[model samples]
Target chain A: MHLTFYTIWPCALFNINRMQSISSSSYAVHFNQRAYDALNGHLSEKSYSKIFIVVDENTHEHCLAPFMGRIQGTYDFEIIELESGEENKNIDTCTQVWNVLSELDGDRKSLMINLGGGVITDLGGFVASTFKRGIDFINVPTTLLSMVDASVGGKTGVDLGPLKNQIGVINQPEMVLIVTDFLKTLEERQLQSGFAEMLKHGLIQNAGYWEELKEVSHFKLMDDLIYESVQIKNKVVLEDPTEQDLRKILNYGHTLGHAIESYFLENVEKKALLHGEAIAVGMVLEGYLSKDLVGLPEAQLADIKNTFLGRYPKVDFTEDDIKAILALLKFDKKNSHGNINFVLLKSIGDPVIDIQVPDELYKKAFAYYAEN
Target chain B: MHLTFYTIWPCALFNINRMQSISSSSYAVHFNQRAYDALNGHLSEKSYSKIFIVVDENTHEHCLAPFMGRIQGTYDFEIIELESGEENKNIDTCTQVWNVLSELDGDRKSLMINLGGGVITDLGGFVASTFKRGIDFINVPTTLLSMVDASVGGKTGVDLGPLKNQIGVINQPEMVLIVTDFLKTLEERQLQSGFAEMLKHGLIQNAGYWEELKEVSHFKLMDDLIYESVQIKNKVVLEDPTEQDLRKILNYGHTLGHAIESYFLENVEKKALLHGEAIAVGMVLEGYLSKDLVGLPEAQLADIKNTFLGRYPKVDFTEDDIKAILALLKFDKKNSHGNINFVLLKSIGDPVIDIQVPDELYKKAFAYYAEN
Candidate 1:
């Protein structure tokens, strides 16, 4: 029996307009112009003992200069820069950040501003949350993927070896400020990678949203699109902060996506796929599985394959590659009691979670993806 | 100006008794025979896909064999052992444990039983708390220090360099089982070391209990003393789980004790001090400071010094050693805005938090300790 659970969070605390910020519990997510004011207001109000801005090499150059110019507060803050990439997102990186915070005498009252992509946000959030048993942290997501997905969830962690997010905690940041201005600095491939998650938000929750997103041929800094995606994810997260049941739906494509991502990352022969690109392939394969196992419409499955394959280049997974990916599935965070669980769509925007897909069907799913 | 805030946690959820288990928000601390039953019952009730018992070298050899014989469940469990010492309680150890858990396919439903002293409990708690954004964990504290201190607080972390608990989270375990039977295997020094924290519980909060603890000449398996110490700490932690105010009293000697411990551990010439032994010296020095800074009575200060010095041999610190220990004070976790904050007793059991000490008074306190 499939354990499907979804609760469309009332969005009771959110303000939809660009002028207003979305508040949840003790924090808020500020967008575009509102983000600038939120950061200014937060710094102006709280007398933090010290301030730290954590960034990656890329964000230090591309985002920090503009952010520093626009930010209203004149407080002294140290810039902690890490090497940019998913490869550096590990305990060692976290140790370096923690040591920096400690050596710099960051106490309970200090504030940490995570100022980069998912790697920076994730690693910074984990360090801040665990440092001195937690300190105040705010996220200024520089990458599109981080702004819409990583920043919204409060999921802070570093990857362990080839395993993705194997070590982390689900602690919310004090605030998340998303400014589309950083998008200009992103490479085309990076921009496309983030767009995949936005596509996911639409596919898993709102059919109309999927249709609207599909019409946009080029990626741009659209406040409305970012806001909507954040709203969808925030709503789900707030309803189930611990990801006990309802939140599992968010991992619809991630089950296979994460394994595939890890496999490519570990194998020297395979080119490293960006998170969104890997998950894009995962969506197509899972879409086929959904049609076979959950009676999703075959036409909708074809549409999903066509849409994702058109945007993300198809990866040629040899049988050995597929076997390695399958081997990595046991490490999926969602799995319990040694059972591999999947979240599949019965129809567009309608998901069924905890469905056990047979190995034979998994082989067929790959076969279908290969043909596409 | 001292920022003193104490909210006597309503004690709304606690049941004080020798026979009954003490329940917290998400966990319980089971004592003596009750611990065995609690473990058996927990394992029987929850069908964990895999069971892992994490221990240091000491516990694996001394405690694991007997623990295995007594455990009622028939489920197979893996033994993940680490080296026995504070030096091993770092991110690297956590990485090792995480890798083992990952290699063993420890999913969200797997259960990890931390069976050892403070180092094991702290490191294991941190690893379990972060692995897969948390999994089910039960701490089986073998040492007296862990039973009364680490087991009560939801503080889980590993040390960064020489700084104590520099990186960690305040996430509680599923339960903690305290079996004094393991104490028989402990060395006399280790036992005496743990006794210091129990002494601290009384000195910080209950003068009457302090008088009673002062009367003991030998360290034995006194379940009642253990229970009371646990009760005192649990009360303080429950009131201020985040250590924002009232809970600071628990760190009465810890500020100096941690620095001294870290100092000794880092210097090759200085012998490693057990957590409690360092804190014992810390209590004596702070007790002198309490007399000088907070009007703790001279006679009570003498009694505190006499009682601890009689039990723990004095470690002669050269002028350089004093300076090094004092310099390490800046790294204390309680410091804020670069100022060292100490918890001093106005009288035995009556403590004040966030009291800044002047340099002259600090030097005088060290001179007093040296002379004593």
Candidate 2:
């Protein structure tokens, strides 16, 4: 199946024709220009008994209308709207979606289209996977973060209380459509939050990609950059679907980054940080640890700190905050037998997995971030 | 790895040596005598970070002590007990289990042993499969129903409200250990509930087995009978893991049986029926439908009715009850595009799928069942 999507540049100055589409053996990841046409073509190739589109509030208002207008075929479909936030990604939302599917007489042959950011794709993919022991689902990620990170991987789940992704399963979708145009609807903070993941894809695997990302001064959603990030993540996931060995490298900054994200999210007195913001701090701190423990060059560590700190404002973590974050680290998913394993960078694009960082190193790493 | 277990029959007079163990490519289904020893040997071969045994209150009191005493290795293990019933098989219970695992530092390397009936295996399998995006789990089914039915099939899930298995995923455990000795602790009715599934295996695929089952009078726990049932189910499941075509035959009477089970369970005034008991009624009714729709021999249909009716008590359904049960049939997992599909038998050993039974035929089948 093939589809051609027209790109309307915001400036209206240059109508440059660019095709952004990447295909792995199992599925294809389509960018904004071809997303609608690709979806339309895919739908036409197969017959679905019922069509259910799941979207959060943000996408329902901003992305749905334009997406529906571009479709070529007339088919019966229903729209299921969810509250737009990370807080709503839980069992309750899954129950609601499951109930809606049941009430609407959705069956094994039904097709579910997840049409939003990470929360929608994660929760919707999970719901689809578990409903009647799984159903066919497609991902139309509407944020830069989801396009670059969530959409590529089959990681689908909801958080258990303060812990993020504590209950989930890895099940791939039939296809993933990455629409970079949706970034136009996001706030600067949200857009930047997504950029952090793109930056991470480069940091963990490709030095040239990391250098190109460093040159991205202004926050612009480029199809090529998003495509490159998807390729990096997809490659890692394909090589290690179960996170046995090679996949651990993808969790480079996620160890402490996730703890920090959960800490800020759960602490009422502290300002909650977007996933990217929390992980940006994580990358900086882990970079310091890498320099000390993994023989990473001090110059490269300083460069990492400068690049992240320039984009993400530093948080003033009190001693109590540090203790709480450290405690939360014990619950990190990467840990096995209570040993906190960190994926530290050996260089800008190289990562070493299962490295145990001492508490003293953790304290010193925090101190370095504070001093910087 | 192999281990031999000596069966100490509850009645010393029946000390017959019975070898009841079956192996598939990935796992084994061991009968009472060999179950514990097999489990011990399997555990010894693997090194786990921690061991968590999940059981219901019934199993904790009646089975846990015996199960623990049989183990030879010294390993740190925790007991997680939940209320025993179908009512507790929901997402809330899953959350409690996940919380316990997280609190106890259960990691990807940790192993979970499910030691109860279908409820324990279904919910525990789901928890292990989704925890940290999946973990290793073993099923030690301690009830006849679980041994003959739930133990062999990889289907794991919880009901969504009144719907049966509306939310779940299909994930196989590392191994499944079935001990028929647990049947000694069950009430007569509970043991009979399991017999219905054994009867189903015969009716769907083996006429000779059906004839042998009809000859049995007492509610005795026979390891050979259990083994045969497990072999039948395992063979069916292995052929069609995803229930694409051949597997639907496994749902023989489950189409209406599940709806009836859900209706009775949800209604406060109505008495809930055990899964096998409800399905026994379903098989009788569907037997009549089969004779009418698929040209099954009238003599065989009569034989099926006589065997089941003689064994299982009839459930009186009011017209309103029938309507509610019919409404619930629309939510059957085997359904596609809102069509209610039934797996009906053309003969004692022959099964057909996707047969659309007319509403009038359904009424007549119920009438035939009532008259019998």
Candidate 3:
């Protein structure tokens, strides 16, 4: 899974080479120079009527120039730049993109290239999937979070109000292009935000991967680690594309994580947390529950708590916050008929799905996180 | 294809019998009492968190009471009604319904019952399909247009501004239930509006069916024609679900028909035409093109024109209206790279797809429809 050498594509303007190719569901994630080559080849092969490059302000400024510099193609490209930030990740943004595509003569044969973080890929993929019923699209994920997780899964959507990804469809992109170089532009906080998911990947599926992550103290953005995270997610996604049975393992942290994310996002008084930040808190709390309910070893529970707490700053959940977050649990996507279901751990790397935690335990889970 | 006898459903509260079932791709089109039986079984079998009955104003008043009176099985239901008409089939309306469903705690396991015409079925289907990624939904089409055409095909969408079906997805419902009794409540205009699609069915695929439709002087709502029409459409849909090649033939009159429909719907001075009314004008015009360009026999072309005009009142297309209508043609769903493609007839029951009509013939097609 390592990029040992570089080979230039014949028609490429820049010295691009293959990174790594990982298969997921119906599509593949092409990394580094391979991604650029894939895009270039895609541009040449598909007689796309039009190609739309979707970018938010951040990517439009930081990542787009480098992207354009590296990619080579002879097709008319439309730049559809959206406003940045999580707040803009809603249906209104989707409507704007849809209107832009329609106004610019984007027919069914047109192709959309989503070139930003999760918000852009999610919203752009959704817009492409629904525009005139649907149109072909590709993803060029530029952030650490998107590269590792969102890029692999065909989970495209927009937030419904403060609810994350409430309205969307699971339509695969042609291929996901991951250019890790773009991650250099991310702030340290953003990098940390994304690394949380990598940690999550280890906790749920592979003890060796968790130990490997534990060995590294600096939270380095290693491409191998990123690739491993993607492979883990892609495996789960492939097994259950529609999030049935086995795929429920992917929601190990997401059940409570999403509610915490939504709670912080909506409350005017609190600061909004990045997805990984909230999910980290969720993993810590859920790990505590896992030990008590699902037979996750006490030592492993302590290890999970310490590992997340070491890298990610622990959120101080007030009594009020805990109550609201619990109420929000019913809105978790995993729930069926309002029963809040959790994916807990039997032990390190061994996950159990559909474990119900009593309401009384939710308070204890929070208290465990709050303690030193 | 006629209902010869009635057989009672075992769990049915009343003497509801199997009508006719025509299978589409993954689902079936159940007609009459069979529709009720299908709904009964679906409700009893699946543990849906909630049931949502989507209706427009017309169906809410005239259709809902009877629907409620007939449907069996104990399940809590929510009634979500929208304003009636094509104008209400947009994202704003989708947002409203989504908000209502979200507010009422509609989860992933919820079942959406679209109990109206194309507006309800199309809009409701799109909503259900995209809600929480996707959800189970059933369509109980109350209009003839819906029963014959929209029901069999999994084409779900809403118009974008004046553009017909500009924003939508191609998603199949759990099943499509057609109760012909609902058509009795429709105005003559509405029923006539639906019959145009049936005429399309006869003209595009079955010459014998075309002759049969021609034999009748009045546009009578017949269940046999509805079933046959649905079966014809179902066959095409099954052959090409995504409208790649064979399905493009479904767009026979729709290229110009949709533009004409959009033009009339958007214009301030002109009264908005029903979908079928505008499509009827399109059929007459496109049929003339077919005779000249695609070698549709002159007698059959004349027959097609007379058949449509006899039932549907002729829409007077002014030169200005024709020009505007032609401009609107580029936005047709069938177009690729701004190329206005038409599905012209080689003969009655034989449609040639993706045929580009010359610009000069525009006025002539309009004149052919206007003259006696």
Candidate 4:
């Protein structure tokens, strides 16, 4: 293995916290050093039928060459490149992968390495999960959002029409490899989009981390900060890998975030919000909602709003548009028996799972955001 | 629970030898006694979010009333009836069911009961398996072939274009409740179709049973025989739930059976081969192939051929027709690579799985049958 020196330690040493255990299978998230060591060991395992790499057009151009270069001759493998976009993540693409793998005589013993952002990790993991009932796969996350959020959870799937993640299976990969090097090729807007999730991660779990995050805003700092943000998410996912309870904490910004994403996707002429962009907006509005549910200090709420507004200048929402977004919230996949349940924060750092906000309270919450 | 009397209990209670032990999530074929006793269980204990019964317009007219009366107060549910016949078991119908199910708020926890013949069982099970990742379902098979074949294996899916079971998942149902009483309303041709699989069960696993089967032709006697056939399948499935090895024995006649079934379905003027009817022809032809593979006495092979031809008359096959049928053999979903594998019999009661048959052999096998 021709390993490049990313960190000072020629042979990097690291430890991982085993916080989450899944019922169906087990998986590990290699923080730094362990992740690098795992690469050699995985390639040496002689029992696999074949190794497969799933990438997108963008990742194939930027990430695949460097990623494969590290372990070039260690294993025999093949590659499948999918169209690069969230719009292509559906059953049609899944069928295409299934057909290709079947034609290649892929069997259950094969391993899949998903080397891209959230789209590749999600769609590739999903394809491996359903192929021949299930197969082993690894997530090599290249984006900050996928590293901190998507890669840790076992949720793998694609969207259906206007619905997000409407079709999917909750199957964890065998391991996840988070290498910061891929971030170098990420576009500036993509880098900014991913940082919003990191900010939300700090806000939901660690008050100390939230305080530490008051540092100056630049996408460059993500490298030094990704480890801590991943830990916060890793802790919650470990507690509830299936999103039955504690995992709901991760949905702090996603409730409204998804609605805004869906709304803008339909209204294509309007500028589309990256998943993280919508969540940034979600955190601001939900902060006001949190103030009503539990007494978050006025200073903290204002700080949350001003911090995000400073990075992402406010996108105006008319009353009608706000109503349409609110209507979409009812269709949220998490809702039970057609009732909208919001994940509200008790404080900037702590979140309470499965709190049902009254319809009247939702109306009030939206009006507060509109007036503010 | 309604207690029912059985003529044979300890005498007919044959344990499936291949299954080491039953798993909690195992697909159970509740033959004679167990199927009748399950009516008393509450719907809440069934682990389904909602219960859906899939019936055909014909079954709605003929068999729905009697079956609904049995499990009426046990659960509050709705019936989804589709158009009758093998012709409608395509992707178009599956899409319609998906649309209806999406609007009904059907999620993973919902249960689908296939309450008619093979078409309902196959298509309904397909719909349930693909709906919202997958849902729990049951098979209350009213037809003979479905009760013995479709209900036993978890291969649920719909046909794609001209291909059968092209889009599907191999997910087991919670239970299979085979009520033979509903067979009273089945047309004679449908009953004959179901009988084909029963003969296959006898031919592949029990020479003694196969000998005894030659004497029985009545519906009442067929019910007892169907239970035995289900036991054979249940035992094989329990051993290899995913069709890796021993389960291939179940495909005794299906290779040629499917080709003939598809051929009949495509031709309008020609009478369609009921699943069993096609298999009857397949059994006769494969019986000849078995003669070549194993040293079967000429008398035994002749007896098997005469019995099938006597029961279900042969359909003429021209050289060109045989070539087309042979080409369709390549599309079997069980095939991974380009190789065409067959489950050939070593003896009347023993099937050898994964026998690689050359393309030349298919031509010879067809030529032998075409002349016969």
| Model 1: number of backbone collisions | 0
Question: What is candidate 2's CA lDDT for residue A109?
Answer: 88
lDDT of 1 at A106: 86
Q: Which of the two candidates, 2 or 3, achieves a greater DockQ against the reference?
A: 2
How accurate locally is residue B191 in candidate 2, as Cα lDDT from 0 to 100? 86
lDDT of 4 by residue, A218-291 (tens): 66646457877777787787778766688888888788889998898778677778888888888877887788
Which stretches of candidate 3 lie above 4 Å from their native place?
A1-19, A219-221, B1-19, B218-221
Best by DockQ: 2
Expressed as tens digits, the lDDT of each residue in A1-372 for candidate 1 is 001122221111223345467776568998777777777788889988878888777888888777776765456577888888899999888877888887777898899999999998999999999998899999999888998899777899989999899999989998998878788899989988988999999888999999998887877746788889889998888898888877888897899999999898888887999999999989998998899999899999988998998888888988888888888888887888888999999999999889998888877888999993
Per-model TM-score (chain A alone) = 0.94, 0.93, 0.94, 0.89
Candidate 4: residue B134 lDDT (0-100): 60
Q: Calculate DockQ per candidate and list them.
A: 0.71, 0.77, 0.74, 0.20
Name the docking class for model 4: incorrect
RMSD after CA superposition, every candidate: 8.5, 5.0, 5.2, 7.4
Candidate 3 or 2, higher TM-score: 3
Worst 10 residues of 1 chain A by lDDT: A1-10
Model 3 residue B127 CA deviation (Å) reads: 0.2
Q: TM-scores across all candidates? A: 0.94, 0.94, 0.95, 0.83
The lDDT for every candidate, in the order shown, is 0.85, 0.85, 0.84, 0.73
What lDDT does candidate 4 reach at residue A54? Answer: 91
Clashing pairs in 4: A20-A238, B49-B109, B145-B194
Q: What 10-residue stretch in candidate 3 chain B is worst by lDDT?
A: B1-10
- How accurate locally is residue B168 in candidate 3, as Cα lDDT from 0 to 100? 90
